[model samples]
Target: MYEGAVQDLIDELGRLPGVGPKSAQRIAFHLLQAEPADAQRLADAITRVKATVRFCARCFNVSEAEECRICRDPRRDGRVLCVVEEARDVVAIERTREYRGRYHVLGGAISPIDGIGPDDLHVRDLVRRLDDEPVDELIIATNPNVEGEATASYLSRLFAPLGVRITRLASGLPVGGDLDYADEVTLGRAFAGRRDVRG
Candidate 1:
């Protein structure tokens, strides 16, 4: 138990996700030892992000403006929309360079354990977009996990009546990964997603 602001710093750092007590203590001490300018810059950056960054009104992605750049871009296909669990997932999909469509950020997946449901996310906004926009297809790119699957399934049912073509991202073993090290679920998905080689 440290005294005064030192303990306060450690406690605040520990509140960050994935930051344990030891890591928080280390970070607090490092900040204490850091050059005043560097620490001030870090504090300023956090403050600036909070002050300037906001969710895009269209896709809910982090943006400085009302809509994200992707939403404003004219080149992207407006008929195709990729739905993801979070803003970070948009960044991940952008790095792939394979998809050329716009996106809809769900805010988060439906997790009953976390007390998160479709109502808790931006799902209503998505349905509204589908109704208002000319979207013909929706790509579900949620993470390949139990909660993600449940969320996808729920979305599939919810969007079924809309008559839009809904698709889920295929999950399988990574390239160059050995079969022996693969989990049963991953191997099974690989088999299910396999396509016959074209001559």
Candidate 2:
């Protein structure tokens, strides 16, 4: 029912992931009715993030510099690498404070139906990092879904001959739930119960 810029804003917002048309309309109206300063701040924040953030050169996580803070931290264990499907999963694991290792953000999981393959992700970078670093173990923290499983399996096979230990996060995660959404307790348990991937 809205016109011009207001409807345009709703349409743009609706295109974002997880935002339905109704939710987008609600948000557009909320921004329109809110103080100009408040809306401006949100817009500025989004703009700044898009402009300033770059992927970490080492781990592929979002960062303002060539390397992310996690990759630069001397305290994190270089001998252990936690492989995740996305950068958001790095934040989720960090919140638990239970892991003191480094991470590799794969960017996306293998989805044959969607035409995403092993080469489409950061798997090559991960393998290169292993060749350069002294990583003793690789913890696969991909989600517990079909695509995630395929990605994990692919990685396991790729890394098998390298002699590094490969482990997968335990099940009992909410079925079809993204790793980014799992609660700290459940996520921690999965980490603790990680099992070796035997080839």
RMSD of every prediction: 1.0, 6.4
Summarize candidate 2's per-residue lDDT along 1-199 as a digit string, tens digits.
7889998999999999999999999999899999999999999999999999999999999999989999999999999999999999999999989999999999999999999998899999998999999999999999978899899999999999999999998765777899989888779877887779999
TM-scores for every candidate against the unseen true structure: 0.97, 0.86
Candidate 1 residues 77-178, lDDT tens each? 999999999999999999999999999999999999999999999999999999999999999998899999999999999999999999999888888999
Off by over 4 Å in 2: 173-199
Best candidate, TM-score: 1
Checking candidate 1 for backbone clashes, the offending pairs are: none
Deviation of model 2 at 63, angstroms: 0.8
Error of 2 at 184 (Å): 23
Q: What TM-score does candidate 2 get on C-alpha atoms? A: 0.86
- Report the alpha-carbon TM-score of model 1 versus the true structure: 0.97
